[model samples]
Target: MELAIGIILGCCALGAGICMGIGAIGPGIGEGNAVSKACEAIGRQPESKGAVTSTMIMGCAISETTGIYSLVIAILLIFVAPNILVNVLLKAIGLM
Candidate 1:
């Protein structure tokens, strides 16, 4: 029972780490693309730099929420999953 619990928790931690890693990838790519395009636009139209930059910033901010959500999930998986798993295990084995 103890070994099973340990394995389960370890897997959960690994899953959380993986989730964080994958979650970060999309935001990173998106932010990079947005900034790059914004800069290119600014270069093409210096008179509209301010507007372009502000819009790009807004877009980046919106894109970042997804990464933040993933991070929250990862945190929950890391910290909360183990406790929940333990409770479930306890009940399953009639210990609860």
Candidate 2:
């Protein structure tokens, strides 16, 4: 029983770490690309800097949602999944 609980908690921690690590990669790359392109656009058309900047900001915010979602899921896995999994394990072994 102790082993099982330890495994469950360990797996949850591992999963959360993996989830955040992978999830952050996309947004980091995307935001970098978006900012680069936005800078080029502003350079090409200084008069349209306001519009381009606003659009870039909006797009970056939208792109960041995926990372935020992963963060939420990671939080759930670290804080919530282990308890639920342990309860299920206990029930399966007829101990609960």
Candidate 3:
């Protein structure tokens, strides 16, 4: 029983770690690309810096949502999933 709970918790931690790791990669790359492009645009059209900056900010913010979602899911997996899973396991085994 204890072993089962330990395994459940360990798995949850591992899953959360993996989720965050994979989730961060996309946004990191996307944001880097967006910023790079934005810099290039501003360099090409210095007069339109205001517009380019605003658009870049919006794009970066939108792209960052994916990473934020992954963070939320990871947090849930780490802090919430283990307890819920443990409870379900206990109930299924008639211990809860």
Full-model lDDT for every candidate: 0.94, 0.97, 0.96
Q: Which tens-of-lDDT digit does each residue in 19-64 have in candidate 2? A: 9999999999999999999999999999999999999999999999
Which residues of candidate 3, in runs, are more than 4 Å off? none
**lDDT-based ranking, best first?**
2, 3, 1
Better of 2 and 3 by TM-score: 3
Instruction: Give the residue spans of candidate 1 off by over 4 A.
Output: none
lDDT of 3: 0.96
Backbone clash count for every predicted candidate, in the order shown? 0, 0, 0
- lDDT-wise, the better of 1 and 3 is 3
Q: lDDT score, residue 82, model 3? A: 91
| Candidate 1 residue-wise lDDT, 18-66, digit = tens | 9999999999999999999999999999999999999999999999998
Model 2 vs. true fold: TM:
0.92
Q: How well is each residue in 14-96 modelled by candidate 3, as lDDT tens digits?
A: 99999999999999999999999999999998999999999999999999999999999999999999989999999999986
The candidate scoring highest on TM-score is 3
How far in Å is the alpha carbon of 30 misplaced in model 3? 0.8
TM-score of each: 0.90, 0.92, 0.93
